[model samples]
Target: MAKADGLDLIAVGRSCVDLYGEQTGGRLEDMLSFAKYIGGSPTNTAVGASRLGLDAGLLTRVGEDHFGRFIREQLAREGVDTRGVVADPARLTALAFLGIRDPDTFPLVFYRENCADMALEAGDIDPAFVASARAVLINGTHLSQPGVFAASMEACRLARAAGGKVVFDIDYRPVLWGLAGKDAGENRFVADAAVTARLQQVLPLCDLIVGTEEEVHILGGSTDTIDALRAIRERTPALLVCKRGAQGCSAFADAIPDSLDQGVVGRGFAVEVFNVLGAGDAFMAGFLRGWLRGAPLAECCEWANACGAIVVSRHGCSPAMPTWEELQAFLRDEARPFRLREDAALEHLHWATTRATGYPSLTVLAMDHRSQFEALCERTGAAPERIAGFKSLALRAVDRVAAGDPGFGVLLDGRFGMRALEAAAAYPYWIGRPIELPGSRPLEFESSADVATELATWPANHVVKCLALYHPDDPQELRERQERQLLRLQDAARKTRHELLVEIIASRGGEVAEDTAARAIERLYALGIRPDWWKLEPDDRAGAWRGIEDAIVRNDPHCRGVVLLGLSAPQDELIASFAAAAQAPIVKGFAVGRTIFADAAEQWFAGTIDDEAAIDDLARRFAILVEAWRDAKQRAQTQAIRETA
Candidate 1:
């Protein structure tokens, strides 16, 4: 048999039309804004491999609808071989509505009933392609349907017969596999016994297994990786690799393999994240890239980590991947020191290096810039107010300081320019400071100080956000000027009275326990400047505040209460405790991005003239606190009255 040329990889499974939208922050009641895009694990994997300069192919069924056409076009554009991509005129394509409440893990709403993709039969997978490829990837979702399931098992049988490597991604959608043949009931949930049995049946045929921590626990019945590995080992000799999102991954190749004496644990790349939708596919692509090049298992795992990091730091899965040249550049530049000031600059550098290495679409940049909010709103068609509410939550969690706002100023890293500022500005309630849009300068501050001096004045209450790089086509001189401005802003943040909160939107969290939020705090701390608050958005559900509580406890510092930007969490007690611990008043800020301050005086401060008396009374109460903090004699009496009132 001829060894596969240029790393032939065949990814077989679901091909879908995905409509993804996320609230600017995670809130269910918030109007969900979103965008539609094509997404599926195996299809994405194929695209990723092709982007890495490998000969990758996708094998799945799609309806002969516009969505199907779009999927084919995307695959072709990405240079993936789609000869085996079947279009069924008889059935509708699988459509999934994904709501990414958190940037890390998202719950999906899938509409897939005998869907076109699930209509795949073994005959649809060409034997020649399987024989030609070195590895074949399959999804458990496809196997949920008996025909597709039989087809995949048969394909694996043939691939094994032909000596090809077989990989299984246990993309277990609990909602999708509910009760197999049983009626939809409590006992018939997809994650029930039936699905577990199906998973067990398929594991023996796979040489490698990739799954989420939850999937592992469900299928293997253990939380411990070692025990899970043992459970998997008993079913199949396939190497077990558990993808643990931020915690990194662990692979058990033993009883023992050459790669590790006992087992292999690979730490994921620490990245500033935007969305984690397709990082898993990116990881698969990276792992294949390394494997094809005869890279050590450890190195393969590193490739996966780096690829996943790159994807999360950017936006959607396939769109955010780095080209081969870009990947090399990032690897080469890993050791280089980051300019102390640019927070998201390092991630941009990573993307830049990856872009230099291979071809990536400009759409990726656009997606990264705005997909999180835009996509969510479109999907949910959420009421505008709800959308604003959710966005405020995300903004509060992230707490991005804007440049022109009265409370705080952001350091503008010129990379995203006005677009970044505008995005921040759109938030109705956030720390987004106003930025002089491109070609616009701070005229108000022009009379009082120089640009740097003016920029620093907002330091006490402002976060200076800077985009360190300019348009990709900008002249080197222009780019250098932007970098210099970033440096100036950094310096200003340090000396000014304001807390410097830098948003490195592209960073990733690794094994260092410094996840994006932690890293953001750490980055500023390393600069010898302490931020009054490190912002973040927790999950959108009722108990989302727990995450903030955990982060606060983990990264204890001289930080105040988090400026919560959304509705009261169901777990208000936990959040209140955090507020008490931080000794910082939890401001019920809006989640409308940077737009929050446009009418800040009216909404947050003024309200209406008719209520002026009440507002005045509230103001007087605050005055007493300020006075009490200053004067001891009247302090006690004022405090007592205020508390009683």
Candidate 2:
């Protein structure tokens, strides 16, 4: 029934809104903030492709609710064609909620039943739509859902029949199919059986299968990569790409004589990460971008790694994505092939260098003493003349990095408060530890100057950060205390920035808050600042459940609305809790974070402040976790109505 245009790609299956937050260093109950972002594997990949200048369209369903509208708007903004993204009057869009306490390790969560995306039928995907694309990228998660499994396989078949390629990413959410309810053992077994059957049917027909090593093992029913490839090759003979995360990625050509022989594997470039949310999608985007540009399979792997490296260095999914020009430039400068090895070997350094080239080297020049700083310089092969005291040295390093690197973060020690050090802490270029304004008495009375003179010397545009008071190696209770302390420090830093701005205003009869300064600066350059005018928070602490919702709309076009996070006691109570919050007319989106994470995964743990890497990773995961929860909540509500009727 559907007609297809000359679309380059049509992404079929599920799409949902992702609601998440960083609670690891602290519990949700302890925090006053959360972030809402868009998520859904198929949606993510489609957007990734679009950001790289591909003509990609999303063929999916979302509810006729605010969440649905947000999803549509997001896709349109990302340059994804949503003309085929159907809206379901009967069901709500799927929602996913994620929570992370520690970002370095994995954060866990799940999907809900009967969401709008799962209700997609064969008729929803028009035959012309399948005919229009060069390829159709499908998510394995859809196969676990009801009508979607059949609809997806049929779409794949139709696409192939119409001479289009099929790309399958085995985004295996194991727990999604695992047993968990009171009768979870039996329910999970049955669900696993149904999913396994669906997978067996779809995989063989795929032109390309992308998955992680763990996913390949699970799908192949074996631990061995080669064995798994041989098994899949026997059926579809499709190109197999096994993504190895930080290790990089590998691929198998269908034309290779020995199907059993291991295919080419490439190591990923090393990158310090701010988040790993959409790294996989970024990889797929790069690989496809390169493949579409006529690069060989090996080069495709290189491109994929480079894209992933760039992604991890940044934040969020679509917003953090790199364009085609960025990827091409990175590849031209950094692409190298080498045999993988352990970290201590020369082969390792060679690999690291190649991969590192893709990322401009961001060195964190830290020192407890001048000698330690000098030693680091020696190790990094920096000339002695370049190594000044802590501040100059850090500035030189930042200049070197910024000249070649897109942007990098820095942490400067507070013990050495050089004049340059004060300057570096401004503009988010460096994070200063154990430092306060010149006259702060709590910091051991370091400087005594005319208070006004000192105020004038401070960087007006700098984002002042207080040193975290928590010990990095403390135990549980101690860690919690440290976390609380750091939060207080964050609060203090915010206050200091505000007070200083207020002081500046008193002197000049104007406002000087950092946010105000940022906006004023952006207006000068005709550049747009991110939407920081509003925040999302819980309406009440009366319950344990929370609802993640759509963005709050403000009457003023210049300001963003406050995000609402609703909490209630437990299950059978979240909807009611959300209903209470909805009584207030301005709430944009509703979500249940801890409730969903606990239900989807295991017990929820808060993150520790000591682990910055983990904090970053966990923050991103929380976003994904929130997405799963919102999706599940809508589906559960829709299913409840279906059953009652």
Candidate 3:
């Protein structure tokens, strides 16, 4: 049985792989290359809806082939449920080649003859899965096939019987309809009495129906556009949305108006057009965003328009589809949430801070800074010899924490943290090494010139931790230098298959900006650099982490979350910061340096306390922080469940 509230939408029908031409202002023959992305109306809508943080699912058939595997994987990665996505071993998945003719037009060619999706059988439909969804979505093409037609009918029946709404996307693809003449101009739709009669059979079943003028004409069986809408309205008062490109779309839930091709429609957020394909699917997703959230009619249309505008300005449909946070963020900015959900970067920074999964609860013992250790030794006057004992104390703590097979990691440098690294190597624990050197703006590094070569030899769990003092307020030269350094590290990790942990301590007092960490993260992604993990300082609110998390997820969906860094603050203060950061799902655990082991180092270096006692004291503080992290993770998850409920 599907979990209650598990699947909000189940979209059934054709899903294909889209090969978009890379070369612009060209014909199909003129294009040099093509970009691959998930395509097809139903698939695009499901992916788009999922990007907006909806609990969506797909019900379709694909060939038991590479393309089919890719479709399922992409959907699952986007958080779409795919249990209903069946693979037929006999046929091939559908494929579409989209060519860039000009800024306004994209020439699309369908290779769907005997495709897997078109071969859907009645036995393919799962009654329980349909019953579980809040809405059941089907495309008009599904009705063109006898076997799939029965399947679509069963889905509609199950959804209605289960008290769920049925949504009809009048996605007219005339080639699928066997229309072979100019009567099928550009393969949009052909106004036919038989097609109109066929669509009318399901008109009464839909709670909401979306289509272009051509699609409405095909569905309503009338030559005149308004007449067709009026015919559908007379049969059923299903909410109708007329998609008019560039001018925006209209909504009618009641009787058709006498107005000539216009009404008091929701205004559209207009932007320069790139490719007009998939605009309809994007509009539907946007409308659903408002309708499902129970927004007013005007606002629903506004959201739809806003979504379409953002998508048009961007590239592919589903990849360009904005998240709820992204859309909300663009809305706030366009007057818009330009970051589209980079706020998720914070959640990525928060609860899920850990990208590598060896540890259940990470109580990191951080004592990796060389300068700090050297300074502590200089100040205490007991001995520089005690620094090795400091690593020893941290190692003891690691051993203690790791007793139950629950893993832990330590941040150590090859300079001062050599003994700690040597000791940690023996155990099955997370090991992090600093790849970038400590300095001011325009950071300096040794192996960064050949980071990829150096990193290729490291252990898989070896997370290269680099600390850079970067903020948007920095000089342009400084920013460029930092970006270059980060990309260097990124290239290394990508080649080595080792984990990367970036610690950006934005220089404060110079800039009193909010979301410094997030902005810094955005800068890295803007440079096409994505780290496996981010090490961040605590924020006052969960919202502060959103940008960082969003950028991480956007740049690399497989990103390990961000961890909290103590920055050597007092233990009491570090505990409080952990409490704030723990509430975020993006935060996996805390990587504390000074606040955790500083006190022990000072006493041990001063000869005021023995090494054994210092280790014990460090162990106690470490234990306290570990318990705090566990407690915080639990509380955050509980709140998450409650919010979901």
Candidate 4:
């Protein structure tokens, strides 16, 4: 089958949220915490295909709620088209609770009573939309219910009418078919003739069929693998792929062979299994990646086997699937480790490549001043309680400037800016909250020493901004303590899935070297603390900026570019610094606070100016800096184009 102009694959079936137990080798009843991720057979396949550089789309329904929005947003982030994902207002999104009991045992519970995905009716499938994709994958679970069965059949009809292949993943779940008890979700197979009849109705419409040995048994009506393959072959002329857990997989395009080894077999990798929940989905995704391009069946099975092997050694399903680059690296590395989770390079590659968003340029107003704000209240005789109101006014100024642009951000503190932060949550602006205590030499958190506990209360969108009064030349004891604290904070950020921005001030007190900022960043990399962003003071020398860029690229190429910080410098000086650092592509944008707000804040606190006046003055100053940065960025782009020419 030739590829279409639109999506390469459209997976029409179950899409739900999966909450995996954090405590490994434990029962679901004893688990204390869980991590949420997108799940379901077809959904996982779509995500896996998208990660492998396929233009995949999902045809499913989710409830009109938080989880629904999350599913859509995550698919969009993964580069999967969500145009066919419907939000059913009447039903709640489906959820699956999974636990890791042992290497071979995984306990699962499906919370899918009248779920939105299952409620998908035939009317939901658009004929034109189905034909736009080169292939439509329908899972067996979606064919169990009448409503979804009609929808799946409609998609299969539309796909075939447009000369598109219909791929059927025999994702057999006995509980989903009412053949097993509700709590028997972990049961992979049950001998049921009714379920086979239902699945057979869609077999002739399929061009490709994938299933495990047990899944084939359920579909082909026999416990014997060869008998199941031959029985299913008689029902459909599609190619059959039998997944044999660790031994690998075999694909049969013609007559069923006498033995399982008589087909085109692909060898599987030798890796320790963690949870075998999503391996089949990963295998199907990888197989399609090759098959859609008209690759040989042997090669397709190889890709499928590798994907399954990688996923089986990881934790969750969709999140654990390998990216194109990661898969290539794994395939090329002869010395690849047996434990995929312990491979730091592969883990970092996955984490960096799968980030939700990327900010090309950010113009932020940093007003996370705690000690400075308190001191202003002290000097002006204003009540300390009024600080919150002042922060609200400042946020208004930022809102006015960020009316149309999404690149604008704010660095506010929870202590005095809680009201502003709450307001910012309603918008799509980049908002960061400070964690470090003001002017702390050895780096102390504002709230509890347990940074993760403090971060647990924060919104996921809020970036964790921590300012360290760290100098590369500090005493060994002080530097080590600060480094330890920063490491702890970084760990917490990773655990909480919050983006981290580490603001470094290398010239805290003594004379600074030209390469101090670079060395400071290098030191952090050596300690394995890679923040998503670095907030650094702009350097006057081009060479200094180059050194910093080299350090970042050499250490963590996926690190988000640096954002220049203003240390209360004059507006003109700050503008000049922007021009000086403009040539460095590593610098994304600026986050200046005191340079824009200090004077107006002082005037407002002293009662020399009213709220509007203070807000207007701060807004005007902020706009000036934003314009300066943009002008410099444009100039740099023009220079780059000229050099390339």
Candidate 5:
């Protein structure tokens, strides 16, 4: 039986990579580009459930390859537990090529010869793990093959023995069962008595059964929908759900209804269908979300229908599933558009919620200084052109310090550091480029007033770092101007699909309260500006850091936590700040500049140190800060563990 704190659901079978053609209303042969996403019936359901706030796990096998690792990592990012997801050394992961030919026709081709997922054996089913979930869901495709069928049946037996419900999704794929040609991946139904008999053998063990109209027809071995329901009911007393496409879904608990309209019906939403590939999987996920919580049948069907509606109007499968917050907002808003894809607010919500990279910590080298570098060159009697070469050398130092560490990043400007930025683009490091004009009090863009047009030319990996010299106590007109500029930048970042990092320096406006920075952040939130990252001046006081953390969490929990910025503070002072900020979990890492680079730059400009010597010195200094930041984080973690103990 499932323990009180065990997982909510475990989905077994069919994990694959889906390469969806980007061009709509085009055949697969004519498509030019494709967007990759994790797919497969059970995998999509697991991702959908996790996104909708369920403690979901996936039980499947992926090959030992790049795509396999990608599938596992993506699943973890979506909050699905992957303990049961095995990596097979013998086979390759499956791939599905799909194109949206039109609203109704989606061409699909599966490259599944000797795929790892289909090689699942009964021995792979861990009884304890199977019992750890309150419900175990197995799709019909797994039962089409002998080895996977054994594994699926074993999971069902273990789940039932441990008092867990078994959920059956008649995920009928005719090509998978060899009833159709290899190219007929989109073929939903193909009547074969043998396939129906095989499905009937597993139907009696299910506690709940869900399928589209065509799927139920195959399961019940009948051409009629009502007749299929009756046939399926005789085998088991499971709660049967019939997916009626645009008409929503119908549920039957006690008896098979004479007609679907007579049963408990959940009305569907009015939305244009873009692609119907993974809609059923999404519907099952939404239904399970409510059913596991003991919600009413009508409520479960409502979520299911809404989820289906939303996915059908969007592009990819798992990526299209709505988060719990998005789902609730859509349900609550009476003015939502009939075509969900046309709703800008909902689209932004979906994009923001679903597309965050998993960067736990970032140690950045902030050398985006323009005026300072030029001034140093002038003071040393060196040509202004030397500044560009110096920025490139600084990038080399960054490369040395951040070699294999994905957590390291660089903040470079395009004016003098364009060469460095171009070189840094080749690496997988977190690259941020400054958008705010240097030391601009009202936050003016360096290139143009139109931020979106400027952002369109930037590489996708470069984060938009805008340093806002903001203060809550500023004169109303000045503060509003700065806020307006920030709002424009935020919108531009969203449109360009670039992450925005708003660096707040509240002290720039003069003497202020300890909570001044936090207040400025709160003011921005009030103006509907939600940055993906917040770069703030580090405070040595724990209370000040906590205030900033509280504001960020209260406003946008999805906002990537803050990174401390150095305002040319001495190395010792920066380290001290790290210790203080480390105590706040919201402070991720530091983006320090002058403390590591000023002395090196000055020496190199004055001919006191050669390029090699300067690079080595800068690398050493940056490494020291990285080590100090890590030590402080370790200490903070230890103290937290001690407190909890």
Candidate 6:
């Protein structure tokens, strides 16, 4: 089979940031924290489609600010093409502050007055790119404004001219339409002929039209749902899908006959609704996922209902769309009620897995050691105060590498590198912080789950890097103690919404450290401690990493792939280890510390080199390691391609 061309689906219109209240059944004022997720109808649909292995792209505008960068990065991380998305320097990115009181009602505030996405002009769109997609999906909110309306029409014209299907999701928000103000309720009903005419103008261009009952009523220029469906069908020879919330949905087409009352209604999944924020978008994506793959209407509707069911039972919008494996598993099991975050099965679905789009591999700089770094400095007769300074030098090196955009992460400790932690989190680089007490053997900590307090407040995107030194042949009592301590951290991770990155290193006296490290992960899995990421000691042989990979796959396929740790190894030895790791697909990245910055740290601490010299040296060494890893990964890919040929 020939390789497929990219951009099968292009979604246009509004894209915004959603700040969802973390605490349920509370007023927005009372909620102390909120989780951030990408929001907006068309954006969510694009992300959902991408999650189902579709080549999706987005066309919108975001502010040239932090939020805008976040929107772009998040979309790109999901494999959504963001080249068509523009960064409007003049306007701020749109934001929605939302709270859920119950299953029936969700209070939402649109902070999108003259926002960037709405500022999208006809000139902002690329006609060729719009025409390239097999289907162009557009939301109705863009029709409310002159500039966005013109752009949406141009896109429709381009897609239709190129023999591409135009899909219209009647995403009618009264507040978005300016028919209702910020406080006039999130869900509003308004029937206006002018709005209907505006929508009807593009009906002939659409091959598929999807809308809820109220949305259909508004666009069809009718008060009744049945009449709304008939009116829409009369105008366009498109397939009409009317979503009826818990009653499932009905799809009507000219070929389906008019004698039927509601047409072909897809059976709905009776999930205990958590929040119905993105169900419609999920439904559209699921329908497209099946339809694009040549499935029949009934099967397409099944996928749509399942996708909607999973999202409504979760917290966030776009991020809550289930992966392909997750959807299959959810559909396969006919078990009891599944709760989000509370149930292990549902929690492992990985709705928030950050897949690489432009850059899949990460070259992490691990400078998080507190006790170890202090000890090394003390032995060299360097001032203790230089620990933070050494960390700062390492951070500067990280900054230089991040500028180039082959993914990178920084691991730091709170004792000295807290400033670096705060700084790195703001950038696109992945941020990780050590949770273990300084130099704890057998995984002992100063207090029981002290990191839990910090974990609760830490941003969700950042990783909690916890280290534990364990020996496979250790005494029973010591082994039991370590397991219990790890269990505490695991429980804390579950409660605090932090993705745990556990670093497992074997005790020095063990048999072949790599084998010991592989077994350690299996032991952790057996103890029911499944982390999102594993930081393992580098292996000398490529095949030696296979056991570790197998253990991770068995424990949690959703587990983010492992990263190779430096283990304070010599530069040449560490480079060899990284070369070996590059051959394993499961080793997603490397977290080499001493190999990248040890000499520079020593020189800076001993006052042999100035801060700038130390920083430049660290950057030099880090870059060399990065180049080595990239070369190895490239060679491995080439070998695989040759083998296939």
Best candidate per TM-score, number? 4
Model 3 alpha-carbon miss at residue 489, Å: 9.7
Report the alpha-carbon TM-score of model 2 versus the true structure. Answer: 0.51
Question: Where does candidate 5 stray beyond 4 Å?
Answer: 1-5, 181-183, 342-345, 355-363, 367-409, 412-462, 466-498, 503-529, 536-557, 567-589, 602-645
For 230-277, candidate 4 gives per-residue lDDT tens digits of 999999999999999998998999999899999999857888899899
TM-scores of the models, in the order given? 0.52, 0.51, 0.62, 0.96, 0.78, 0.87
Worst 10 residues of 2 by lDDT: 498-507
Backbone clashes in model 4, listed as residue pairs? none
Clashes of 2: 54
- Candidate 3 structure quality by residue, lDDT tens digits, 212-308: 8889888888767789889888888789988777778788878788753454377666566766777778788888867776778778787787777
Task: State the lDDT at 182 in candidate 1.
Answer: 24
Q: For residue 206, give model 2's deviation from the true position in Å.
A: 1.1
* lDDT tens digits, residue span 1-645, model 1: 226352378888888877665354554335354445567889888878888878888889999998898889778767888888999999888887655455544555667877898888988877877887778898877777798898888778878887888999887765566633322211112336666677788887788888876667656766654565667778888877777676666677767344322456664556566667788888888888877667788888777877777777644566667677666655665553332113443433333333211211000001112233344445545332333333222223233222222332222222222344445554422233432232211112111344455554342324443322123233556534544444455455543433333222221212222243443334334434333333343223323344334544444322443433211223333233333222222221212222222222223223333233333433343233223222432343465579899
Q: Write the per-residue lDDT of candidate 2 for residues 1-645, one digit (tens) a residue.
A: 113446667888768877655344444335444445567777877877776777888988999998899899778767788977899999888776544434453243445566788788888888877788888888777787668887898889988999888888877665555445422211111224455456767876787888877667656655676676666666677888988777788787764334322567654586665456677888887777766556788888887887787766543455446666556655565333222121122221222222101211112222213344445456556554433332443344344434433233333434453555666644334232323343221221122333223323344333232322222233456444534433343334332231110100111224333233223223211322122122222333322112112211222222212223323235345444444333332333332233322221111112122233323333343334334334544655576579899
For 93-153, candidate 6 gives per-residue lDDT tens digits of 9999888888777889899888999998889888778867888998889998888888999
Better of 3 and 6 by TM-score: 6
Backbone clashes (count) for model 3: 40
The window of 10 residues in a row where model 4 has the poorest summed lDDT is 1-10
Task: Supply candidate 5's per-residue lDDT for 597.
Answer: 92
Off by over 4 Å in 3: 1-6, 180-186, 260-264, 335-480, 483-645
